[model samples]
Target: MIMLSDWHPDIIEFIISKMQNPRILRYLLENTEDEQIKKAAQDKLKFTPLTAQEQDMYQGIINYKQIPGLGGFSDKIIKEAEEKLRTGGTYSVHNSEFLTGANISVCLTSDFMEAVENDEEYSLRFPDVEKYDEEEMKFYNENWHEIGDVREWEQMGYKVRTYRKMRAKELWNLINVCATYSAEPGIFFIDNANDMTNAKAYGQKVVATNPCGE
Candidate 1:
């Protein structure tokens, strides 16, 4: 057998798309230094049938970015963040029970939280505001510039929406649902996080936090 470990990370990653052996995928996940290989292993594991123990291990890889006791080395709580870098939100996880057990903290903006509460489709990273109402449109146009660099939005001519205040009951209901499943997602004011960050001067904004809220 040509050992998977003998191959380079890039080769192993390419094979990951064609290979289905759980054992080899697990080995790559546990041993690989290249994040591309690690993430590819994770993507394969998501569809491959796993034992209970293996499922737990897979969830750990998904949440590996911010293991509770570990430091902030990875970028985010799920593959969605990784997907953004690779494909620009073309492939994103819509929902997952796995995230509840992944043990990663998530932060949602007011507009996103409201959309989820109303069971409407929305995106913070790849925003589309044309479907929104005039009020929401105005809200986005007024605040989008303050939260992040306005140059990109202006060039795209897409005014990203934000909520001045979210409905309390809707917000609490979302919280309760996550809490019930022990999928505790911490809520933070996007505007507040952006306003307080020193990175604003550098044209960066705080979109999310680490497991420790750093």
Candidate 2:
């Protein structure tokens, strides 16, 4: 009998190396011994790799989605990530400029959020009404990542959701040109709260900002 509560990777791996039972691999619950999990992760080793992607690099990939020209690292990115979730598609991201300063703010609306949740193609791209009134819809918007540098208790999507639109590679390139220092876009999703909660009162149409809100 193996304890299933342990999370120790080495211990579990050791046990799996010895055990050949298939049923034991099934029905693995949490709080169980690390050995049990090691057995499971190893049993499915062919699927889920023993490696994990760095969050910052992943965050960079996610941040790219916020950029104006970029298409949120392409919807297929998430698909690929999910498919390779086991293989661990994570790759290191290296770029000093991308993280030099956290500026150029951006925000997301509830409607956009709905799209991302329901529609696979829907982008959390900022959708504004009065802000784009007669203005170009390209990078013609303002930055609206959040109400201020001071925000709390907001219902957030995946942590990456804050940087939802942006992705690692694209952000690296933009950093080369220094979008972080200029527009200083802050990335976040609070549109549903804004429209429903009346945070900024942009009104029904919707509005967006490149690095700052209107």
User: Against the true structure, whose TM-score is highest?
Assistant: 1
Error of 2 at 179 (Å): 19
lDDT of 2: 0.34
Clashing pairs in 1: none
User: How does model 1 fare in lDDT?
Assistant: 0.46
The estimated TM-scores of all candidates read 0.30, 0.22
- What is residue 97's positional error in candidate 1, in angstroms? 7.1
Task: Please write out the lDDT profile of model 1 over residues 78-98, one tens digit for every residue.
Answer: 564444333322322213333
**Candidate 1, superposed: residue stretches over 4 Å from native:** 1-97, 104-106, 110-156, 159-168, 180-183
lDDT (tens digit, per residue) of candidate 2 on 79-174:
454445433542222232333433333343444345445533222222333344344333233423332211221222211122133222222222
Name the top lDDT candidate.
1
lDDT against the true structure, per candidate, is 0.46, 0.34
Error of 2 at 33 (Å): 34
